[model samples]
Target: MNIKYSLIKKEEDIDILQGKESTFANLHYKYNKETIQFLKTHFYRQDSLYLVATDENNAFVALCSLDSDWWEPHHFFLREIFIMPSYQGQGIGKVLFEKCIDHANQFQAKAIVTETAFENIPMQKLCEKMGFTRWDNPQWKEGITYKLFL
Candidate 1:
C-alpha cells in the first residue's frame, strides 16, 4: 500500500479525516456539522497541528491532532490519534505518532503529553513503546496521562 502522510489543509480533508464509521465519533462529535465547526476553530489555531495519513487512493487511513498545553506553554498535548480498523496493524498509527513527535520537536516543545483510559491496553502499550511514562497528578482521575520529554 502506498501510504502518504500530510498535514490537513482543506475543509474536505477534514471531512475525509472524520470517517463515517469512526469509533472516535463520540469523543470528537457524531455530526459532520459540529465536527467541521470544531475543526475550523482548532485547525487554524496558531498553536494547534493536525496531520493525516492517506492511502494511494487518497482515502484517510489515520489522523493525529495536537495542541499546545493551556497551562504549560512549552508542552504540547496530543488530543487524538486514530487509525482505521483495517489499517490498525499496518504501522500507520506509529507513523502518525512519529509525525506528532517531530512537530513537537520542530516547535521546540519541552514535552508531549496524551491521555487514555485505563482499559485501553493497546493505547497504553503504544504510549510505552513511544517512550512515554505515566504522568501521575491529582487533577486528572478519569484517565491516565502519559508524557514524553524532548
Candidate 2:
C-alpha cells in the first residue's frame, strides 16, 4: 500500500489527534483526550516535527514526533513513534523513524533520545536495532531510556 508522510505545521492537522484505536503486546493504545490536548498545547510549535503517515486510502496509519531538547540543547527528543497494528511488521515504522533521524540531523543534533516501556519488546528492539544504547537514566526507571549519538 502506498503511504504518504507529511510534516505537520502549527495550527494544522489537529484532526490527527482523533487517531485510531490500536493495541500492542496487550497494551491498549490510542490518542486519548489528555494526549490530544497536551499535543495541541505543547507540541504544535516551531522547531519541532509531528510526522504523520497516511495510506493510499488516506487513512492515518502511523506517526512519529521529533523535537529539539530543551534540557539538552544540542540533542533532539523522539517524543513518540507508533504504527497502526494493521501496519506493523511492514517496516513503515523503521522508515518513519529514519526520517525522524534525518530531521534531527538537519538541526545538527548531537544525539537523539527516546524512552519506552520495559514490557514493550518491539520498541526496545527497534531502539537497539537503530544503534541506540540503553541509558541508565537515574531520573527515570519505570522504563528504558535510549540514546543514539550522532
Candidate 3:
C-alpha cells in the first residue's frame, strides 16, 4: 500500500489529538489498556512537528510527533508515535521515527528522549535499533526512558 507522509499545522491543542481509530482497538492490552503510553498526552507545544501518514485512500495510517523538551531546550521529546496494528512490522513506524530524528537534527537538538513501558518490547527494540540508549530518569519512574544523543 502507498503511504503519503506530511506535516500539519495545529490551530488547537485538541486538533493534534484527533484520529482515534477502531482498527487500533485490539492493541489495548495490559501495557496499553485505556490507551498507549504515548496517547496519555496533551498536544500543547507550539514548537513541535505534527507528522501524519495516510494511505492511498486518505486514511490515517500512523502519527509521529516531536517537540522541544520544556525543561531542556536542547533535547527533543518524542511526544508520540502510533501506528495502526494492521500496519505494524512493515517499517512504517521506523520511517516516522526517522522523520522525527531528522527534525531533531535539523533543529540541532543535542538528543531525543521518549518513554515506554518495559513490557512494550517492540518500542524498546525500535529505540535500540535507532540508537537510543536506556536512560535512568529521576523525574519519571513509571516507564523506561530512552535517549538518543545526536
Q: Could you report the Cα RMSD, in angstroms, for every candidate shown?
A: 3.1, 1.7, 4.4
Candidate 2 residue lDDT tens string, 20-83: 6767677667787677666566464466878888999888888778877447778888887878
Let me know the TM-score candidate 1 reaches against the reference structure. Answer: 0.84
Q: In what order do the candidates fall by TM-score, top score first?
A: 2, 1, 3
> Which candidate leads in TM-score?
2
Assess candidate 1 and give its lDDT. 0.77
What TM-score would every model get versus the actual structure? 0.84, 0.90, 0.80
- Point out the worst 10-residue segment of candidate 1 by lDDT: 22-31
Q: Quick one: best lDDT, which candidate?
A: 2
Candidate 2 or 3, higher TM-score?
2
Query: What would you estimate as the lDDT of candidate 3?
Result: 0.75
**Candidate 3 at residue 1, lDDT?**
72
Better-scoring candidate (TM-score), 1 or 2 = 2
Residue runs of model 2 more than 4 Å from their true location after superposition: 10-12
Regions of model 1 farther than 4 Å from truth:
17-19, 22-40
